[model samples]
Target: MAETVGDYVLQRLREWGVQQVFAYPGDGINGIVTAFGRAGDDPHFIQARHEEMSAFQAVGYAKFSGRVGVCMATSGPGAIHLLNGLYDAKLDHVPVVAIVGQTERSAMGGAYQQEVDLQALFKDVAGDYLVEVNVPEQLPNAIDRAFRTAMSRRAPTAVIIPSDVQEEAYTPPAHAFKQVPSSPPGLTRPAAVPSAPDLRRAAEVINAGSRVAILVGQGARAAAAEVQQVAEATGAGVAKALLGKDVLSDDLPYVTGVIGLLGTRPSYELMRDCDTLLIVGSNFPYSQFLPEFGKARAVQIDLDGSMIGMRYPTEVNLVGDAAATLRALLPLLTGTPAKAWREKIEAGVAGWWRTMEQQSMVNADPVNPMRVVWELSERIPHDAIVTADSGSAANWYARLLRVRGEIRGSLSGTLASMGPAVPYAIGAKFAHPDRPAVAITGDGAMQMNGMAELLTIARYAHRWADPRCVVCVLHNNDLNQVTWELRAMGGAPKFEESQQLPDVSYADIARAMGLDAITVRSPDELGPAWDRALGAGRPTVIDVYCDPEVPPIPPHVTLEQASSRLRAVLKGDPGGLHLVVQGAKTKLREVLPGQDR
Candidate 1:
């Protein structure tokens, strides 16, 4: 049989090394789904419970695998459902390609059933690359460009394929739609390298500074060693943005932990005190946490020229790939080792972790959330692909989990959304089936997406060669992060009735889905339960009941924020006073010393 337009699309995906696609089917996309069904084992179509999950799974796949993530949806609502997850990809700068099934071309303008203006709807989210296949012959090139644009830009791309066009027989093009470039369609061009003059300028700025600091972001993830070398040569201390948490080890003497609200005190101190700041690949948004404008001479290195100095004033903008730029700039500079700065960062980080350890070890009436994260972090395999949902769970994992060598993971950092943990784990497992994958999620986020997606894991759990997937649900029975935020903002606990979840057995739900599952109510049970989950060598869910009152406190607290907490407590909010007393008694002891009652 001659190939169909749908067949060409699937073939292009396979040619580009996309082995799996997360999808949810509807009438509008029946043709493409049928084509995917026929394509067989190469590009296995994973049927997710919702289109949102399909998109999130794709995001997770791309993050862990370093390849373009692909997801598909039917027209109208199905396509609309993909926006949230696609936005997650866009904001996080992950490469994801979304294929939306449009109505038949003849029916599009008539406002027919399930006819959504896919282009119009996706403009803001997938505007970087959004195209609807107008002709059957355009499918191949469109597919190729969509993938290439997504990969090169590290953003979400959408292709709207009409069902009628998908069903049409594919024919060789009469002539090219546009001139074919010399390089292959899906291959990305090399990142720009900095000019000698730019490199020399950046080098001069750094060499002239007495105290230097480097702030790394997701852009510098591949340039960890280069960042370390630059920091070492310049006598600089390193502070990573939250997205770049795994780029370097927290144990590095010159490395401070994350910067910003979820950051460490040492990191904040570094940014405040540095005389010169070298920003590589991180357009970190929190300018308030950055060095004061006039206090520091700044230089930035980025592959994207537009983002080079968008976040801060730059004295020297070195527009190039982070590692390459640093390598080139290294030889031009007269480097001096700032032993004083490095030692200061090391001591601060040490003291901070010591305080964190004390807080994490406190025994609450229910299991402390920090303890759960700490135990899981300690037990997971070094190579495990860990994912955190955006909530208190992300905060705990950020503060407590020490990602050493080869422990790669991701969070919904930029979108700051919840419910991605489950799909992320499933996708990570598919990408690296031989390795273990873990998802640390909260009760609210777990119910939102993970609860349904757990069944998706069950359906394909055996397909993976050596599946060892773990979903650890921190069942605090409340939207703890939001509740804390309300208290932090001087508002009473108004969301408790709305945000507090019913005490349902997540472990029971997992068992019903035919997976090994357990619920832990005490700290002692935490370790054994984790051991069982990891050792099961199959998909497992461990529901650990955590203390909902514990706060995900930031490294620094302003007087206004402290006053808000006090106001909330004075207003008779249930957990506010308890949280304050707990902080005073346990968390503040190491830091406040004599002030702790």
Candidate 2:
């Protein structure tokens, strides 16, 4: 007469397009674990040793399949461990459902065993959270909300499932719940563009400006064609925010390059030289690169009303979607392509490509960041989903690795956290088992994240990309980059401790977990190691001993930030002191390498 809670959840998940649930079991979730075992078929159960990896695995799976990724963990520290990975999903806009088993409702408040304020802890990171503590029927809507939120916002959603209730029996629905939609998404566009006055002002600025540039962001992904048209017709050039890289063809004539610290010089110079800059989509974070207030006129079009003037000031704030806004701007422009200025932007773009070709060939003895990621881009299948960790890893990936369209990817576009890559890779793999998935992680990222997720890869061990997924550990094994930043900011400790992390032999860790693993000592060994990883498929671990100091932040970063973080360290704030001595900031880029070129 009574059905267990796990069955109820699993049964509903199947109807919702969630085929599997990844999680690490614990005493806290005994009932759910038992229920999962008894759930027969359909929504399969995945066992991950570490809670963090369970969430990571979900991220990887979600990327390709475009399905809802589900991962579970027991209450207390176990559930807490999943937060970092969840934050990753939230930041990258992955539609993930994290089912956390809470402490028995009775002992929850007092911390029965490993309990903490799980909801409060996760609040800052997740796009939203759902706590299901009551009637079983209520779960369907909560689940529905999680799925819908994830898709609409492209972020992670948390579902806290209490332990006592996990096994509680309930009637099964005669039919399954509605499936989650993953693709061919829609948007609500305003019937009209900005007011006539604003449009007139923007037009006047465009008319007066000889050299104009257009900067696009992640929101421009859907408006690629419209954006390209505007660029071509107006003699305007294109500069992209990091998330906008794949929005347009890399070789588009008017695209100079990405603009930011990881960005190329061409984009920067173009932005500086251009008289008017049109921001198609994005509240791009970096104001440093934006034209100084009085220097040049800038216009921004966005869907969110609150986004206007959130970061860089805008002369014209058009409240509309990117596609529609561009379409509106297209007709207003009477000027033919200004051949001279257009030629200038094109030259800069051509120079960047030329620079890329020249530097990619640089055979540095120790192996450079550019070569590592460039070669990786070349070696990995074009369709492979490349997930990246924060820090130097992002910079390396941003500059060297080329994303072949919106194949598959997950990264903290704004938050820029580490550790997400590993968990995201797991999620991506689960969502799309048929596609090759890989995660690029720096030593700092793995150190902060659960190393045990490597074990999760071996559990399903499905043959997708044969060695369908691989982890390339850029093993500088230290937070050297952060320490330098701290030191520069005048915060580094006088007696800087060698915060270098002990060499983590991921190969050994992977082998211990029954996964194929290899460690490359030099550039020469990298190819062979990759071949083994790729050739054998299944999940393989490739740990490469590369320099952590070789960051991807523009070399100008070496000049140091205006605030001397190191000088602050010398002033003796113990926590601050520890970070500086530990070289924490040095590892900030976990993905952004030092000398990417």
Best TM-score among the predictions, by candidate number = 1
Q: Whole-model lDDT, candidate 1?
A: 0.85
Question: Lowest-lDDT window of 10 residues in candidate 1?
Answer: 176-185
lDDT of each: 0.85, 0.69
Clashes counted in candidate 2 amount to: 70
> What TM-score would each prediction reach against the true structure?
0.96, 0.81
Instruction: Write the residue-wise lDDT of candidate 2 on 156-245 in tens digits.
Output: 887777777776776433345642222222333344467767777777777667788889887677788998887877799888788677
User: Which runs in model 2 stand beyond 4 Å of their true positions?
Assistant: 59-68, 91-94, 107-111, 126-129, 171-208, 324-329, 357-365, 405-408, 447-451, 463-467, 487-498, 508-519, 524-538, 548-597
For residue 106, give model 2's deviation from the true position in Å: 4.0
Model 1 clash pairs are 235-338
